[model samples]
Target: MENKYEDYKNEIKEGKRTLNQTRKELGLPPINGGNTEFINREIAFCRKIQERR
Candidate 1:
């Protein structure tokens, strides 16, 4: 499937909005992907849970 962000170029240009602002205006999350700390913490937690099984 095509990536959806590619479809936003003209709307973003016409609105004079940054990608982050566009996402916010569309009621999407402020960040597209989780940050490094959240990702690392999730990985560590999953590893700990797996070790108990």
Candidate 2:
């Protein structure tokens, strides 16, 4: 079976989904306007995923 993380990453790469959307699909809480720290962390995680490509 394909990894869900890989699947989500590919969906993002293909412009089929945004990070926030993927997070919601993964059951993560949405990052709100005041959640700068969570937003930055998610951004950093995305950067790392991109680096792996």
Candidate 3:
């Protein structure tokens, strides 16, 4: 199965726009950072979760 994010780069791009709009609405910090950390952290978290059960 094709990863949606890989197949649909536009979705993430559009989401960035929507997120910015929401951030501005609430005056939150800009979501500008590498997703690598999220990927690594989630992978580790999932491994831990799977190990538990």
Leading candidate by TM-score: 2
Estimated TM-score per prediction? 0.37, 0.54, 0.36
Looking at candidate 1, what is the lDDT of residue 47?
100
| TM-score preference between candidates 1 and 3, better one | 1
Clashing pairs in 3: none
Clashing pairs in 2: none
Candidate 1 deviant stretches above 4 angstroms: 1-34
True-structure lDDT of candidate 2: 0.89
lDDT of 1 by residue, 1-53 (tens): 55656657776777766777877767755554656676577689999999999
Ordered from best to worst lDDT, the candidate numbers read 2, 1, 3
What local lDDT score does residue 31 receive in model 2, on the 0 to 100 scale? 69
Best-first order by TM-score: 2, 1, 3
lDDT of 3 by residue, 1-53 (tens): 76644544554476754655555555544455665676577689999999999
What are the per-residue Cα lDDT tens digits for candidate 2 across 1-53? Answer: 88989999999999999988988988887767898898789889999999999
lDDT of 1 at 31: 53
Better of 1 and 2 by TM-score: 2
